[model samples]
Target: MSRPLIYKGRGSLGNAAGRFEKHTRRAEDDGWGSLDAELPPLQTEIIVDSSQSVISYNDSPDIPFDRSINPYRGCEHGCIYCFARPSHAYLGYSAGLDFESKILIKPEAARLLREEISKRAYRCAPLALGTNTDPYQPLERRQRIMRGILEILAQTRHPVSIITKSALIERDLDILAPMAEQGLAAVYLSVTTLDRTLARKLEPRAAAPQRRLETLDRLRAAGVPTGVMVAPLIPVLTDPELEAIVSAAHAAGAQSAAYILLRLPLEVADLFEEWLRQHYPLKAEHVMRRVRDNRGGKAYDAAFHQRQSGSGVYADLLAQRFRLVCRGLGLTGDLPALRTDLFRKPHAGGQMSFDFFD
Candidate 1:
């Protein structure tokens, strides 16, 4: 059966197509003529992921935050280049389409966060939301865990930073706007490309480029500190749109800008390679050639300082261009610090506390 390169409203699962040595979901010939040749309809499955805690701490020097919270494990937005795809393997799921369709949810994220934050030794620092899989993925509209976490952060006056590409975030402005008023929150909306067609094929389920721009404007108008992240900059595919994206975002009220180079780590490398072969067959070889150029002749370089920004001719040039364009548009601005001193644990109402116990 001839598999489809693109699905209408969804991203193609990486597991169903292409050749890889190892995979949990195996495709077999059903001997059903056209049915065998056609891509089957895929459905999204949300599984409950019970957790012992919600907050995850990281000490990576390159990452700005020491802690983050991922309300879900696998992302349904299905960006083919997602570095988080490999995370699904730990759950015995394929990192391809299975990673996009099979999701894991932390049902008690908000409650656990409240418990963690209310502990005596817990010190406040800027915690990032959506640092791994997007906490505001399409499923967030229904799950609302992200909103719950935001509520807990709001009630405790804990500072946070959010990064996402979903327009659903606009739905939480009531919580976000009020928090923004006190410098407790900021947002960085990501726009990968201005071309809608390319965006559909690339990110599959993410909002359109124009919609993200509108969201940026709305966030800024609501007094939320907004910025733009032109992330996972593919060498030949979306790299050309860098300057234009930065300029548009700046005009849309983005106060600052940042970017990360394409990272084809582990299973993601195989998935993206197959994706390139399917969509950009003409330039697949050329594209990966440049990717390797930036990755130091390897599929990826995990070196911390050198990882976020790669090392190569094109990488150096891209950095130079980003700096020049950001400076020209004044996308660099001093951001207000999120207030840790404002943190006050939520009072467990109606709970008995002995007066002068000790």
Candidate 2:
């Protein structure tokens, strides 16, 4: 791994220059460790910006929800395979470690969500969370942005669907439980793999698989509609565990299940390649070969319909495996639609309509 050079009181450009100097010195010294042996502790920086609007609209035919909200930019989960990793390039940052360490929080998200929904043109639909980045990432613990958004949704009696890999959702059972009772909420717990060691390295900041299972149980017990998402099923890496993961999630009280095949787009391809070489060096070549087979002899194929699930015999087999296991486990192929009929706009000075009903 190439160590990022740090320059005290200097920005990224200065740091790069320092790295060049260090490289020259190391080459002259015949590859010896620096005499000052201590490495700097990794620091996470968060900048909170107040977004004018929270709800973002999407017209993609492949996605289920038309509207979504992301409370934070650049996830802390550190999943190398995340297709959203490429988004960090817009910020002039590397999609590798920088994508996980530099986080942007939307502090005014809740207020903006309320304002958007109160508009006369606003239509009722299930608002999705964690679509681009996990809404319940570790930073949410302190920022409470997701919680604030949920609170607004609850206040308006709006429908919501969340996809997350964190146990932090348990903390909002007070809000989710009530919303679920009214058919206003559903949750999807994303479990990529059951292997603890692999999960630790692949998704360093995410909650453990076991903890996620427990979270599902808690949500089910609380009467919150819940399901499991075995997302981005890697070709050779976690593919073999498809059935096992579905069966285990079923046993853990997941009412439905879904999966997405691995997608390597833009910077994500290079980032994932680096990760495979670093962690699964022995299987690196095999994995990339299978991935290419799925992608029609390339690292990725970005055609609209073919983007989510690749095209090939390997992709077909993976889909077949998922369908068979899901049926055997008696899990619903898709989540029940959250009720949008219950939605109401909350006014600034007046109480919400639901409050009068209460």
Candidate 3:
């Protein structure tokens, strides 16, 4: 049998078609030499998103915030276990390689946000960034969409929260630090694993674990409220580092911490399983067995409360451990609440409303 092809820096090994596609295509090796011919590395393709609006709102009980801004549609970090992967299918793209290699950017995000929030019926609340994808992903360096959005948020004195796995956020400390000083900003760095090798495989293009910790420290020093998320705590793969991750974040100046059980919604299940079979063949079966144990003998359970942290002996133990470690490290509280009272809706002419001094 032909061995599976591996792309050096990419996370997904295959590019299966999106579920909504009416037809599917498969690669087949024929007698000709073309099938196995060496091909050039795939390049990232940037597509402009022509969305008229910038803010997305959701009422899911599991989510802490109602409104969020995703400057980009597909994430370049290419984490195989990302629950957001399935969302790519809606754009007629695969949940695997295509999701990482094909990016959609909203160049007008800041303008749209300003228009939306300046409306008479608009309400002020803490808007979230990097919820569906990393706002600081590599393209942000060239696109600068996120920076423009932050500039508007800062100008309006609007409350904003962010989560990212990239060190690129440091570049915006000038904007974030001042907003944070006014209780209008909070940031969370998502640390998957401290193992360099695993991180390279899991999120090939994201920042290194140690670099994220250092970034957290810098944010804290700048007076930016910092939090750490030991996300997607895989059972056999990353469970052992639970306490270590919390302790390390505390030492790195994180004021709060949280975690999520591995989620395998839709195509993410197959992609993640394939990744395990390729990277951890020996422990693949055991890892999945434990995952199913946490999911009540299934690959996943989509129930809101049960989804973040499954319901089982192992899940219970993991939660108890997290609580204990957080308590010991004084990480038991949430990040300080963001301020919405200071929000100022700029007029159509780009000046603030005149009722301030009255």
Candidate 4:
């Protein structure tokens, strides 16, 4: 077998072909000695997504929100275990390295969102951000697409729920704090693991676990309802930090908590397995065994209710432990329901109500 390819700060072990690709390619060492030479660093490529619509509705019974807006198609955070990675294949890109390096940004997201929600038939409901990919990913710093979307939402008095692992959200306190004061906004920071070293490998470009906690505290201090998500809880790897993460978030002023067990769907399964073998070779089989125990003897099961948190003995235990710890930490309740009553229908020309100014 050939040696694994490890990019300095990237999470994928290798750039595997997407599921739809008919051609398969691999690197083979010829006697030329070029295979051992250092590879050029990967650069992020940005593509503009000219999609006319911004809101995507889903009927998945597992999730709470019905509609969501993803300003970007591929995430730059390079999380090896991202469930959204497989989605890159639909765009004719690899679900491995290409998913992080090639990003599709929607520069007109705000205008499209304004047009959609301003319609006479449109109904107001809390819109979700970061459901598919992190809205505050590193690219957002320069793109500011998320900020523009939030500005429109705030002006229309629309309710929104945001999830992210980036400390960059702190910079939007001026916008979020006021919306939250009116019960129109809530934010959840996904804390995967408390160990800084492990986190760097698992989610290479995301904010450190400690930095996320500090950002949560800052958001709470600014009167923005803040919560914590112990997301993608890997069985034998990061599950041990569950209780500790909840406790730490509670200490940091988290008012609500949630979690999702590790999900390895389609191309994500192979990518994650490669990551596991590269990072924790000895424990890879043990970890996958525990995952299969939860996933009904397979690498993954996509049944509605069983997909997020698996269905089995191990799954039940994780759920029970999360509930018990949350109860103990006074984080059992959900964030206040966002208000739709304050929504103001915009004019046909996409002009927002000026009631927000006064």
Task: Report RMSD for candidate 4.
Answer: 1.0
User: What range of 10 consecutive residues in model 1 has the weakest lDDT sum?
Assistant: 349-358
lDDT of each: 0.85, 0.82, 0.92, 0.93
* lDDT per residue (tens digit) for residues 178-253 in model 3: 9999999999999989999999999999999999999999999999999999998999999999999989989999
Q: Which ten residues in a row have the lowest lDDT in candidate 3?
A: 349-358
TM-score, predicted candidate 3 vs. hidden true structure: 0.96
Ranking by lDDT: 4, 3, 1, 2
Model 2 lDDT, full chain set: 0.82
> Candidate 4, which segments miss by more than 4 Å at Cα?
none
Higher-TM-score candidate of 2 and 4: 4
Q: After superposition, how far is residue 47 of candidate 3 from its true place, in Å?
A: 0.4
* lDDT score, candidate 4: 0.93
Most TM-score-accurate candidate? 4
**Per-candidate TM-score against the hidden true structure:** 0.92, 0.90, 0.96, 0.98
Model 2: how far residue 263 lies from native, Å: 1.0
Instruction: For residues 36-101, write the lDDT of model 1, one tens digit per residue.
Output: 454656789999998889999988888888999999998989998898888887887777877888
- The TM-score between candidate 2 and the true structure equals 0.90
**Order of the predicted models by TM-score, top scorer first:** 4, 3, 1, 2
Backbone clash numbers for all candidates listed: 6, 0, 0, 0
